[model samples]
Target: MTTAEEIIAHLRSLRNQRNIDGMRRFGIAPTGEQLGIAAPVLRAIAREHRRDHELALALWSSGIHEARGLATLVEDPRQVTRGQAERWVRDCDNWAATDALAFLLDRTPFAEEKAHAWSTRKAEFVKRAAFSIMAGMAVHRKELPDSVFLGFLPVIARESTDERNFVRKAVNWALRQIGKRNARLLGAAIAQGVKIQRLDSRAARWIAADALRELRSRR
Candidate 1:
């Protein structure tokens, strides 16, 4: 039972001011006691305490940005719950943390449910998590039938109008990933992309054009 404090203490030792400054230039704003640790280092730490659910929870409660990212890595998907997912997502203040949470949450049993629930969320990071999870699932969840992703096409189309940079990028990621999954979904995602292209919003057209470019080239 490695304690969260001990791990966070270790994280503090690995902090890099250069890394922190570099991350900020890419829109990864500092949030809550960030230690300026690189992601690969955190991932290595998580591997050390893999599947430590209690430790993950405690780290998350600490409200340290990198600790929260490490929490996502160390958590057991089997132990994750809807309540925890909601709580952690609401804590996400940056795109990096949001993507870390999405990467882990996408492996949970209730990922699809949370994806839909969070997609319509008012919070920018929360909404980004929804599609980030969707994008991850498309790449990794092979056992899930195509119908699951097919159902997601409409949601992707609907959300394409979001003008926020993070949300639109994630929406495009989800669409492109789904189209790459299989021939059937490729056709479906492409059609959805074309429909999205017709939407009045600038964000929608950008999302559609980017997704359609890759998806069409693949066809």
Candidate 2:
């Protein structure tokens, strides 16, 4: 069996000196002095232990910034549990890690329920993850009803007032993705943007204004 320690050691060995500084320059804080390994290297690590859920969990829980990056490379999202997914989001302190794990989870079977449930979470990133999942599904899950996308409008309206950098960004992302899907949704999104602009909060105003501009565009 591939051991978690062995996997971490392998990841450590593959660390690229140049990439760690680049990651920090990009605003991802490093937990230590050494630069983290690249995604291709991490993906190669994940490929070796593809069937070992326990090993994968062990590698993820090790909490190196890049380790979580590797966690996303876990070819089978089903092998991961809700607890694991939720925990990863909670542990996320940066946008890159948060989106990486979210992208992985969004591709899985349980994505819809989890996305809707987490959008209601009080925690910023958890809610952000939920909305991010919705954004991904907007493009990928074509079988879903338009009503499902419509249902998220209320959450976006309520959460648009969230002034936190990450949360509002995800809210904007979800709204933009939904608006771009079709002409009818574009109109609905424009209406919602108007409503959001009228809110008392500055964050809400910006979100509404930004969304309205692009949503009204012909692209």
Candidate 3:
């Protein structure tokens, strides 16, 4: 039987000879833009080791793209640290990797607290990572309070004007998710969406409009 370590080593060996040029042909390359791995292969590798967080961390640090998928496969986010999570978020150069670690795995003990904090970060990817986790958590953890989701409205209201592709998308995603959770929150989200629309920016307008369209309709 291949122990997890042995399996990781084997995977690392394969990475050593990975054809970056060829991978790019298929829209997959070690761009090193965000932890340097393609999305599809990472998902596949994550599926293979869906239960081993320790192994996943080891694999993630290996700097192989597929290992990141495994990191997302980790079921227990508590195993990963805030430091490690932030490091990965900083390393993220693309949406797939940023969301994979932030939304999929790498759960810091202070995830909610950190998400709020990181939302204010200047780095595009890091800020998106924070909000992406907020979106993911809305779906992943149902027990969170209405106050918790309501709190995110201010973040969205402020960030709505960012217009940056990754950041706005994530902020919008978080807003939509909070709205979808229940009727009470839907009303709150709708109000915030209206506030966002009044902001003096195209990005803010779009964010509010799009979020209002969905959140209002559902309620």
RMSD of 2: 2.7
What CA RMSD would you report for each candidate? 0.9, 2.7, 4.0
Clashing pairs in 3: 34-93
Pitting candidate 2 against candidate 3, the one with the higher lDDT is 2
Global lDDT of each candidate:
0.92, 0.78, 0.74
Model 3 CA lDDT for position 80: 68
Q: Estimate candidate 1's alpha-carbon lDDT, on a 0 to 1 scale.
A: 0.92
Best by lDDT: 1
Top model by TM-score, which number? Answer: 1
lDDT of 3 at 99: 79
lDDT of 2: 0.78
Q: Write the per-residue lDDT of candidate 3 for residues 23-60, one digit (tens) a residue.
A: 45554444542233445655666565666766766666
> Per-residue lDDT for 67-126 in model 2, tens only?
767767763677778877878788877777777877788778888788889878888778
TM agreement with the true structure for every prediction: 0.97, 0.84, 0.81
